[model samples]
Target: MKVGILDSTLREGEQTPGVVFTMEQRVEIAKALSDLGVSMIEAGHPAVSPDIYEGIKRIVKLKREGEITSEILGHSRAVKRDVEIASELEVDRIAIFYGVSDIHLKAKTKTTREEALNVIADVVGYAKAHGVKVRFTAEDATRTDLNYLVRVAKTARDAGADRISIADTVGILYPTKTRELFSYLVREIPGVEFDIHAHNDLGMAVANALAAVEGGATIIHATVNGLGERVGIVALQSVAAALKYHFNVEVVRLDKLVSVSSLVEKYSGIPTPPNFPITGDYAFVHKAGVHVAGILSDPRTYEFMPPETFGRSRDYVIDKYTGKHALKDRFERLGVKLDDREMEQVLAKIKSSQGTRYFRDVDLLEIAEEVTGKVLKPRPPERIEAVVSVKCGSNVYTTSVTRRLSVIPGVKEVMEISGDYDIVVRVEARDSTELNNVIESIRSVKGVESTLTSLVLKKM
Candidate 1:
C-alpha cells in the first residue's frame, strides 16, 4: 500500500507554546503544503475560535476552487460540539480524537472506558452521517491496553469511521514496539486503514513512525519544522526524505520540501535548528578536511541524499579542518585560480589567521591577493578608493544595508550619515577593476536606490 501524509502543522503545530499563526499565515501555509502535494492538510481545530473556523472555511474554499489539490481536513475532539464545528466548515475530512489510555481516561477525561468507547462511536457516527470522511484517533494509544484499544478501533469502524489513528502522545514507542503495535492492529482490525501520529518527546518520532509504516500503517501525521505541543511531532522534511531515500517510498514532491519548510519556519517563529535533518542550515554543509575532500571528488561519498533533491545546495566550510582540495574547489567556483606556490601561501595564511571562524568567497579572494602580492586581475593599481552614497526607504533598510556593506572584502567602513545620502560607504581596493566590482555589488543591494562614487587622488 502507498503511504500518505497528513500534515498537521496548522492543528497540532500551532499548539506549540508561544506559537500562533495569523489567519493569513494559516492560509499561506495550507497553500504551500497543498502545492507541495501533501495528501491532506489538517487546517486547524475550528472549535478553538471563530477566526480559526473562518480560516478552515477559507482553505475549503480554496480546495473547491481548484486552487489546492490536496484534501483539507479539520481537527475536532470526540465531542458532538467539536465535530459540529468541523462539519459546518464542509471540510474534506474530520479528525476526531479522544483519550483512550487508562491514565488519560482516569485523570484527563475522568471517564470510564465504556463511556470513552461510546463517545468515539457517537462522534464518528455523527461525522460520517454528514458525508465527510472521519479519522478517529486514540490519543495515547500506545500507552493503552491492547485489547481495549482494539475494541475502541472496532467501535469506530463499526460506526462507519473511515480511518483509525494510533497516537504515541508521549512519544514512548521505539521502532520495535511501534512495529508490534501496528502489526497486531493490522492483523486484528482487518481492512481498516491505520494512521500513525508519533510525537518526539523521547526523540524517536521519526523512527517510530517509519516502524509503524513498516508494520502496515498507510498514513503518517507530521508537522513542518516539527512544531507541536511539547517536543513537537515528526518533522515532515525528515520523514519524507527518510521514506524516499531509505524505504524508496515516494510520498510528496521532494523538490518543494525545503520551500514548504522555509515558509513554515518563517511564519511559525520557530527557527529550524542548524543541525536539523534535510532542511536545516548546516544539514548539507561539509567541514572536515577528509569529508570535504571526498565531497569535492564525489558528493555521494559523504552525502547520502543530495541537497538538490530537496532544492538545497551543498557547501563546504573553510576553516582549520579544510583541505587544499576543498580550498581549490572553492577558489575555482569563484573564478579565481591559484598556482601551487600561491595556493600554499594562501593556505598557510588561512591556517595562521588566529580565531578565524570561517572564510567567505570574498575573504578567500583577499587572502589570495595578499599572498600573491598582486590583485586577481592583470594591471593591478597601487591603491583605489571610492565613496558611495545610498538612499534608503526606511531606517530598517538603512541599518540592514550598512551592516551588509561593512562585511564586504574591500570595504573600509560604513556610516549612517544624513544628507542627500542615508549612508556613506568607504571601500579600498587593490585595483580599478576590483573597485568597480565592489561598487556595482553595493548598488545591487535591495534597498539601495543610487550611488555616486569619487576616486581619492591622494591620501595625505
Candidate 2:
C-alpha cells in the first residue's frame, strides 16, 4: 500500500502543555524529520505567533536551498487572513481547519454550519489561487454529522483543496468506526486524497490511523513521542512502524525513527514513556527470567520485530527476576569469565542486594574480582572503562540530556549533578576507537557543549 506520513511535531506537538520549541530547535527537528523521509512536515501555524511564522519561513528556505526534501505545510484557520499569513510564508502547502461538528460550531466558532462551509470555500480557494496546495481539515470531523461533513469536504474540494484531513479532534473513534468513516469518505470524495489526523485521547490514535489507511487514507498525521494537546496525536514512530511491520508498507525511513524520536523528545521536553510502543527506551528490553530465556533461545519467541531493524539494540536488566540464562549471557557479553560456582555466587549477591535494578559494568567487575580472589580482566571489547563528564548549554533541559546519554550502548550510568559539568556518564568499551565513537555520539547530542573523559586505571 502507498502511504505518506505528515509529521506535525512542530505544530500540534507544540500545543502539548508546556512544550515549546525554539527557532533553532524547530529547524533542527525539521532537518531530522526530512532525514527520516517523512512526506510532509506541518511546520507550524503561522497565525499563532510571529516566532512560529519566522520558523516556518526558515524551514521553507531550507527546502529551497535543497537542505530538506519534505514538503513544508503551514497551518491556518478558516479566516482569509490566516490563509494569507500562511501563504506569505511560502510554505509548499497550507492546512486550513474549521470545526464542522455542531458542538464545535456552537462552542468554538459560533458560526452556523452553512456559514462554516462558506468560510472553508473562501479560504481554501484563496490559498489555491496563490498557487499553493491546500488541505482542508474538518476539525472534530468524527463527531460531525456525516452528510454535513461530506458537504464541507466537497466544498473545499470544489474550491481547489487537493486533500481533506479527517481529524479525530477528541480521539473518540474506535478502530472499526475509524475504518468505516474513512471508507465512506473515500467512496464519497473521488479526487482529493484522504489524511487521518487522529488524536490519542482514547489511546487508539495509532490503531485508528492504521484503520483509516486500511479504509483509504493515503496520509497519516503524527507527532514525535505523541506530543500534542490533551493526550496528543498518534506517534510518528508508532504509526511508521505499524505501517512497515503490519502492512509491509514503508512510508518513512525505519532506521532513522529512534534517533529522530530522541531528537524530538529532547527538544519537546516530553519524555517518551518507557512503555511507549516503538521508540521507547524499554521497547525491546527483556528483564523477566522466562522472557529472557525465551529471547536467548530464539528472539522470535519474545520479539515480533528485531531491535536492530530500528537501529536499536536489545537490552536486558539484572534484578531479582534475573535468571541463570540472562546472567550467563550478560557475563559472557561483558567478557567476564567465571566458573559455575563463582557465577552462582555473583547471582546470589545480586539477588540479595535489596532492590538494585541495574549494576554498572564497573560494579560487576568489582564483584567478580571479590568472588574469585583474583583480578578478573575482561576480554577485548569490554576492557576499557571511561568516565565522561558533559557540560550542556545553559538553556538545555538537564533531565533530557541525561536521558539521551543513558541510552548510548556503551553507557552504563548517567547522573545529573550540580557542577561545571551537568552530567556524568560512565561507559564501557573495547578500545579507543569504540570509546571515541561513544564520545562523539555524546558530543553530537543537541544540548551537549563539551565533554571531558578519563580512563579507569583500577576499580579499587
Candidate 3:
C-alpha cells in the first residue's frame, strides 16, 4: 500500500514550547524537506503571526519558482476569517480544524454539535470557494464518538474538503484502537482520503501511524524530529523507515533522512538524543563484545536494517566489554598485526584502566604500543581548525589571560578582542579529541570565565 507524508515541521513543530525558527531557517528547512521528498509541507498558520505569514509567503514563492517541488499547506481554524487569511497566502491546501469530541466541544468550543457542524461547513466551503484545496481535521477525533466523528467528516466532504485528517491529539489510541478507528472511517467515509496525525504523549506515535496505514489511512502527518506540541508527533524518519522496511512502501528519499534530520536539529536547537531511533548517534554503534563480534561476522545478525540504507555507517566502541575478537579486528583494521600475547596484555590493561570507561582510538593505540613494546607507525594526522571566543572576568587583566592562552601547545594566534568576548583565539589540532583538549586547556586559564568554539569547516 502507498502512503503520503505531510510534514508539519514549520507548523506543529514550531508549537514546541520555546521553539521558534527564523525566516531563513524556515526556508532552509522547507528546501530540505522538499529535497527529502515529502508530499506536502504545512508551512505555518498564516493568521497566527505576521512573521509566520511572511515565512509561508516566502515558502510559497519558492514553490512557485520551482525551487521546491512539494505542495505548500497552510493551517487555520474552522472560521471564515482564518480560511480567508490562508486564502490570501495562496497555499495549495488549507487544513481547518475544530474539536469534534464532547469534552472538547463543551469545554473548549462551548458550542453544541449541530452548531459546530455548521461552522465546519461554512469554513470548508469558504476555502473551497476560493479555488483552494481543503483538509478538515477533527481535532481529538480519537476521543470523539465514532458516529459523530463520521458525521463531522461527511459534513466536511460535502462542503468540498479534499481530505479528512483524523488526529489522535492526546495520543490516546493504541495500535489496535488506531487500526479499528481508521478501518471504520475508511468504510464509513469513502471517496475522501484520510490522514493520521498521531501524537507521542503515550510514546506510540510511530506504532499507531503504522496501524493507521494498515487500517487504510493514505497519508501520515509528521515532523522532522517528531517535534510538536507537548510530547510531539510521529517522527518522519521513523514513519518512513517503518513503511519501507515493514510494509514495502517507499515514499521518501531514504538516503537524505539523516541530513534533513540534522538540519532540523541544528535549527531547532533541540539536540537529538544519542539513543534516538533511525538518526541517532548511537543507533548504529555497537558497544558490547558479543554484539560487535556478531556485527563483524554479519551485520544482519545484530542489525535488522543496515545503516547504509539511510546514508549512515556502522560504528563500534571499545570498552571494558571488549572481547578478543573485537580487539583483534580493531588492530587489523589499524594495520597493526598483534600476536596473541600482546593482544591479551593490551586487553587486560584496557579493562583495568580506571581513568575512563570508553577508550578512544588514540588511547587504544597508545596502549597497544606500550603492551607490544614496538613502535607502531603513526597514523596520518587529521587537520582540524577552530576559532574560540573567551569571556573573561571583570576584575581579571585580559592581557595575562591572552598571554597564557597564547602559550598553549596548539594555540597559533591569540588576540584581545572587544565585544561579547575578551579574546579570540585560533587553533589547529590533529583531531576532535585533541581539539577538545585544547579547549579544556583554554578554559583552565585563571582569568577565563567561559569559552565558545566554532569549527572552521571551509576556508575561502
**Using alpha carbons, what is the TM-score of model 3?**
0.86
lDDT of 2 by residue, 61-100 (tens): 9999999999999999888899899988889999999889
Best by lDDT: 3
Q: What is the lDDT of residue 328 in candidate 2?
A: 90
Q: Count clashes in each candidate, considering only residues at least 3 apart in sequence or on different chains.
A: 0, 0, 0
The global Cα lDDT (0 to 1) of model 1 is 0.87
* Model 1, runs deviating above 4 Å: 378-460
**Root-mean-square deviation of candidate 2:** 3.6
Preferred candidate (TM-score higher): 2 or 3: 3
For each candidate, the alpha-carbon lDDT, in order, equals: 0.87, 0.89, 0.90
Which prediction has more favorable lDDT, 1 or 2?
2
Per-residue lDDT, model 3, residue 313, is 95
* Candidate with the larger lDDT of 2 and 3: 3
